[model samples]
Target: MLQLPHQSLQVAAVPAQRTAAREDQDGPWHTEAVCRRDEAGLFFAPSKEPTAARLSREDAAKRVCARCPVMVECREHALLQPEPYGVWGGLTAAERRVVLARRRRREMELKKSASAA
Candidate 1:
C-alpha cells in the first residue's frame, strides 16, 4: 500500500464573535480586525441601549476600524450581509440599514425612469 500526497481538510476555529462565513478572502481580513483583539463587547451595543450611548460606542469602534488594514473589506462584507447588529466595518447596524434603504430607493427610481423613457 502506498499513500499518495493529498491535501488535508482542516477546519479553522471560529471565534464567538464571528457572525458571517469565513471561507472567502474576508476571513483573513476579519482575523486582522482590531475588534478581534479588543473587547468584543465594545463592538456590540447592550440591551436597552440609549441612542447617545449607542452613538458613543459606535464612534469608539470606528476609531479602531480606522487603523485596521482590512477596514474596507470588512465594511463591504458587513454591507453585503447587512449584519443585523454590532459595529461592523466601522458602521453601526443603523447605518447599514440606511445604506440599504438608499440603494433600494435608487434602484426603484432607476427602474421607474427606465420604464418612463
Candidate 2:
C-alpha cells in the first residue's frame, strides 16, 4: 500500500488523545466494529445511544480513521457492503451513499459509451 507523503505525515502526527479515544469501551454503543475488522460487518448494527449525546460518538472514529494505514482498504470495504451506520474511512453513511451512487452512475455511463462505440 503506497501512502501519499501527506498521509504518512498524518499518521505519524496523529494526536495521542485521538488514539486513546478509539480504545474507550464505555460508550453507550459499541463502535468497536468501526476499527476491529477489515470488513464493515458489525458497523451497520443498531445500538443504544449515549444518554448525553444526540449523535453517536463517530467523531472520534473519524479521527482514528484519519491515521489508519489501511484507509483505502476500509473505504473499499464500506463501499462494497454499503454499511448503513457509523462513520468509516472518513465518510459518513450519507457520504458513502453519494460515493456509491456516483460510482454506479460512472459505471453505467461507461457501459453506455462502450455500447455506442
Which candidate wins on lDDT?
Answer: 1
Q: Write the per-residue lDDT of candidate 2 for residues 5-29, one digit (tens) a residue.
A: 2321112221111222222346412
Residue pairs with backbone atoms closer than 3 Å in model 1 (clashes): none
Error at 115, model 2, angstroms? 0.7
TM-score of 2: 0.53
Best by TM-score: 1
- Candidate 2 contains a number of clashing pairs equal to 0
lDDT of 1 by residue, 12-103 (tens): 23235545455564455677777778445667665676776556666777888888887887887788876787877888788889988999
Error of 2 at 22 (Å): 24
Worst window of 10 by summed lDDT in candidate 1? 1-10
Residue 98 alpha-carbon offset, candidate 1, angstroms: 0.6
